[model samples]
Target: MNDGTQVHLRLVRPDDKKLLEQGLARMSPESRYFRFFSAKDRLTHAELAYLTELDGENHLAIGAARYLEDGTELGLGIARFIRLRERPEVAEAAITVIDEAQGLGLGKLLLTMLVLAARERGITRFQCDFLARNKGMHTLIERIADDVRYGHESGVMQAEFALEGPEGLYRALAGVARKEGHVRPGSGLPKLETTNDS
Candidate 1:
């Protein structure tokens, strides 16, 4: 983060439903709107289940949390991708960062990790849909995707891009992570857990 906060990245588990709910409550209305594309006050039981209970191969989610001095972890952000059944090589990706953590490059870190996970699962392309007013998401995608094709419909913008090519998506994300100070000298990207370990 720009503020030098050390955030831990890990795979989300079923036990994290409450943590995710609390994180959603902590987000501002604008942040919620930008993320969910709606002014939702709470997540339903089914939605919570869908978000937390993930099969590492198809529906993968990575969570970010900052640990306080007292060892209490605060949820900061999440990035996930759900593989398209129709197109096994493609997936829909989404990321959400809390309002307080916005603009600190946490999103980019989460995205970089997510892309790595996606590649490991054999996903070669990513499709994203966001509100037209979500300029932050647009800018982030623009920075990482080389051949991004965009389409607009009913105030929503949909984008699709390949994950592998001459200009590797992973390389682009690594570059952004370095520029944002998330990558430390002599240290590679953070390790991501593939299991649902609590």
Candidate 2:
């Protein structure tokens, strides 16, 4: 069990479907809209199945889990990239953190891990879509990704960015605090920590 503030990052598993659902339930309606781009309150059976299934290379996902003293686990955040079949080198990335965990640097940490994971599988470009009002996310993308380009359509903002080489990624990781959390379930990327001051 963690000390409540500690978040354990690991590869997503099929069994995490329930935890993910619970995390969604805890989100505010606004938060839900921010992540899903709609007022979606529930995950359909098909949606759950799709979210839980991961192929590592094409549909890779990582979860940030917080454990209580009683051995209960809660899904604090998730970051994933799904490679397009038509463009194997490109992937769309998405991340969502529970409201309780927001502003604690969890989203940044998860995104950093996702970038490393995607680069490991030969993914070169990452795309993301969000509402134009979500300035926090925009700032985050600007901070981490290189060669970023933005597009706007009907109030929605889309960003595409290229992943940097190993040296840059390693430098970013090294700048973070190593004691905050650990990315696990096996990672080929450098093991640098991201600040998680929760």
Candidate 3:
């Protein structure tokens, strides 16, 4: 066994296929169920590829958390960014975490790291689309983001959090997005309900 504990956050390499599989296998069934909405014990090869892919337009960024000393793998957290082709200034964020690591603030860490990377790539806002049934996502969004918008029509709630300046300002700007869900955010955040938006 690799006994992965200490790890560095880095881009997933194509060579890390086995490591990725091992990490996913280590997740509790419940975590896997929530993260993937399935009870299956493993990720399909295609799914794994999609989860780790890092294309500029449609990319997957995984932050592998580990114990720093021994390079042992502790857990893996994922952040995915999708660019809006029609409106190049916009993008979206999707995330998932392994069960054992959910409450350890790794979600925030993964989100921060990914959002920063998105900013580096010129993405100003990070938005989410998750099952309304997932309260965890709602809590996560409400805590770190400005505010959340709930869509009653399809059970889809999308949260918008700015990735700029101070975290407080981000939240406040997010608050504006909450109100402006009916309007376009001055800089970049798109309307929440449009399928054309993303």
Candidate 2 has an lDDT of: 0.79
lDDT of 3 by residue, 55-97 (tens): 6445646454555358554546655678777755567777677
In model 2, which range of ten residues has the least summed lDDT? Answer: 184-193
| TM-score of each predicted structure versus truth | 0.85, 0.86, 0.67
- Global CA lDDT of candidate 3, please? 0.58
Total clashes in model 1, counting residue pairs 3 or more apart in sequence or in different chains: 0
Q: What is the TM-score of candidate 2?
A: 0.86
lDDT of each: 0.82, 0.79, 0.58
Alpha carbon deviation, residue 88, candidate 1 (Å): 1.1
Among the numbered candidates, top TM-score falls to 2
What residue pairs clash in candidate 1, if any at all? Answer: none
Measured by lDDT, the strongest candidate is 1
Give Cα distance to truth, residue 62, candidate 3, Å. 3.2
Question: Is candidate 1 or 2 superior in lDDT?
Answer: 1
TM-score of 3: 0.67
> Tens-digit lDDT track for model 1 on 161-193?
988654365655555554544444433233333
- For candidate 1, what is the TM-score? 0.85
